[model samples]
Target: MSASVPRLLVVGGNGFLGSAICRLAVGKGWDVSSMSSSGKPYATPAGHTPAWAPRVKWHAASAFSPDSYSTLIGESTAVVHTLGILLEDVGYKQSVKSGDVFGLVKSFASSLSGGDGNPLKSEEERKRGYEGMNKDSALTVLDTLISTTPPTSTQTRPFVYISAADAFRPVVPRRYIETKRQAEIEIMRKCDEHPEAGVRPTFIRPGLMYHPHIRPLTTLPAFLVDLSAKLSTASGLPNPFASKSPLHGALESLRTYPLHVDHVAAAVLKCIEEGRGGVVEVPEMRDWAGLGSKKKAEVGLQGQ
Candidate 1:
């Protein structure tokens, strides 16, 4: 808890998660700046920029260009990396079809196989092809952050990475999990390298998130869960509703579900305020859950 207003630089601030973080930070009186490829004011669905947008500065930068974001990182008291891609764009696909894929694959194989290529080039292609883009981007960002940031000041500055809960599980694809795992290693290494910098690196892995303002089509998990429940009930099978975890079930029950966008915002603020910097899984807002529990407890207390 620094006495002065903390400055936060959020990467990919125009994105869903990033924008939510920005809104929450501004509410908490933090000086927020957002960097995006477009470099334009972030507009909400209501056709207007949020009030916080006026107070926060915006930077146009590309993750591929380390120099673009280096200065911003230098000035900020904290940095939150909210950037991730589930699929490659057309341009990226075209580049991979060119010679870059082979070059990258060769380099990756070299690091693992001592330049022998004994496992065979064809084998490497089969194993690493699906993961090249994600792995490369994650590694590039990690390297840029570690190399460009001032080693001395890092300890005092916290780096929070928003990850998915599935990232910790073995069931998740290597293509997805490997990228996050590598980023974790990079953060840990940076922290170890600059103990004096006082930079604390932390990760927050939230399960599927649902906001009413967000488009329904954009939320695949919620849609799927609801669809599955309906189809199962129509077939006259045992109601499969309660079998799912509370998080997923709550999302499926959109109409009655109580999770609000503000609650998620509050959770992010709580993490930063407490300075509990580490991997926090399922960081749902306890306040909302507590209110419900309090009502039930009150009934029991009165009866007793």
Candidate 2:
């Protein structure tokens, strides 16, 4: 990596994934500014208050409110948006909406129909709905980022969106896949609109992320996926693991390819440095495996 660090702004920086990216960028000597809603207290994962926090200029803004994010984008070389929702709960609603009425309605309907409420058989249908809601969020943020900060002639400011790879496949739930795809579309549109500004939008899809400290219960899904894949391979059935019962199965191909959060952050940094703008799908476990193997081989060669 080059020592010439760029100024970067990370939206939702105090959150789990956002914080990871912030730490990596700071380590790389990049001038990083992290923004979160006002009164939203933030602490580093290590339990230490960020030294830069006092000087880094934290902004109080909501992802849904472009006006709130306007001032934060000034003179930034790159912006990363990592806002998302997993399940519809109270906290999730606060992050994405004011209430979970819509989510509750869908969940109740799905339960009544025994998971067959949606007539759309394909995963695309489900994804469409998911994207419908999330696109608004992406657009709102993009609109502010672009309008407030115009890039200089020499600067090619890139916008990075943290998405999921499920959109590429038909196996994942339509809601999850569709929302990510929609967000990607909005990102592309923003990039297209500001070609002169050199605003390049990149999408990063990470599968089944789990940190070393991630709770055991959180890994249950992945464990079941590994088991199913093994069983399917042994059963001599083509895709014996065809079912989407395990979240890990969707990302099993990446088991040996695990990528740490830091690695993903580094990749984002690389993209900014090289001005390489495109979709980068990173499966946590699988990317890490590949990296580890490569390192081991390099070490062995050095021993020789």
Candidate 3:
């Protein structure tokens, strides 16, 4: 795995988490490229790329269309799929903004009932749904990797999927986490079927990743999560994350453990360097970043 200088292809590299991974990858002196719908980081100045963007190749491409990135996959030794959705539609945020308890209850009911995601670039919906965005999009990358890499290749290149913990099970649509799991399962299945393929799977299941400077709104909630972690250590509870807590139904976001996005990016880099494969959880990520139980910083927050 460490035989050659690593070349990384980050799918959705311009998004909130994607950019962080790309930044860390670039910092490692790795040859990095990012494929985002916009072809560049968000909020780029007119006719000017960000300073960090120069070292990286940014492709404005669609996740469903492999043609947009097949050539890149052939050149890349590793790939990271960061594209996914958390809700089928405007679920909890809308209800919370209006303080509509009835609406909130109705949203929960609709989530329980389950529904389809937005269509892929459906001119009507103009967005991809869970099936397309979460599962199929990663498959698109896997299929492209299989097609582009040679069967005689001996080295293993890691494919990292940015997945979610089941923290939103209480409030969000069930399909949100389900699609994530399916993506991981299917990616592994494909690699198993094609043992000679260049891709190896690593799934990152982070819960409520917060960037205080980049996403100020998540600052307060992240502080709460860290405090809970400190409490869990002192109290000797099995875990402090409210993923299974009864009150999760009321305040899911705050109660869930919050991992910092920077730590997550660092962990991804470590996983690839160590040639590690398998599903990695939130606490493990902090440990991988050498943060362990005392993860605290008054830092600030987003995309590649």
Best by lDDT: 3
Model 1 segments more than 4 A misplaced: 89-155, 167-174, 218-220, 223-264, 283-304
| Candidate 1 clash pair list | 152-197, 154-197, 154-198, 154-199, 155-197, 155-198, 155-199, 156-198, 156-199
Clashes of each: 9, 20, 6
The reply for model 2, stretches above 4 Å from the true place, is 1-4, 39-41, 44-56, 91-133, 167-173, 214-258, 283-304
In the range 143-175, model 3's lDDT, one tens digit per residue, is 988777652468887889998877665566666
Give the alpha carbon lDDT tens digit for every residue of 205-290 in model 2: 76555444422222444465545545654565443454354544454443323345556666777777777778875543244435
Whose lDDT is higher: candidate 1's or candidate 3's? 3
- The C-alpha lDDT values of all candidates are 0.57, 0.60, 0.75
Candidate 3 global Cα RMSD: 8.3
Judge candidate 3 at residue 91 and give its lDDT.
58
Using TM-score, give the best candidate's number: 3
Better of 1 and 2 by TM-score: 2
Which of the two candidates, 2 or 3, achieves a greater TM-score against the reference? 3
Per-model TM-score versus the true fold: 0.63, 0.67, 0.78
Q: How much is the lDDT of residue 271 in candidate 1? A: 65
Q: Give a tens-digit lDDT track for model 1, residues 31-94.
A: 8999878977777655678778777788998766778887777777777777764322223322
